[model samples]
Target: MTPITSFFRNLEAKCCAACGQMIHEQAESYATECAPCQEQASFDAYKYYHQKR
Candidate 1:
């Protein structure tokens, strides 16, 4: 497989994008970050976009 396809295929194995945690949930296998990281990222993004200049 090409490098790009290999990278995406690895996504099916559950590697957290932020913390590098090994996730075991089938639902999160395709997700970039595990639950906590995803939550924190979402919260951070919300704050970043809404915060005062």
Candidate 2:
């Protein structure tokens, strides 16, 4: 797949846009942080719940 397609595919897999953490699909759209990462990334909160640990 193309690089762009591969990136979005990662989103479908609930991967963090910033840290590549695996998380819930529900947190895919408009998100980049999992629960743990979100907590620490309060400065730049990732909409997603699958943030890095």
Question: What is residue 53's positional error in candidate 2, in angstroms?
Answer: 29
What is each predicted model's overall lDDT from 0 to 1? 0.76, 0.66
Model 2, 1-53: lDDT tens digits are 56976666665467766688787856336676677777777645654444675
lDDT per residue for candidate 1 within 1-53, as digits (tens), equals 56975665576456787999987686434577888998999999999989955
Name the lDDT of candidate 1: 0.76
What lDDT does candidate 2 reach at residue 10? Answer: 62
Q: Which candidate is the best by lDDT?
A: 1
Cα distance off (Å), candidate 1, residue 34: 0.3
On the 0 to 100 scale, the lDDT of residue 3 in model 1 is 98
lDDT of model 1 at position 28: 33
| Ten residues in sequence with the least summed lDDT for candidate 1 | 5-14
Could you list the CA RMSD of all candidates, in the order they appear?
6.0, 10.8
Residue 6 of model 1, lDDT score: 62
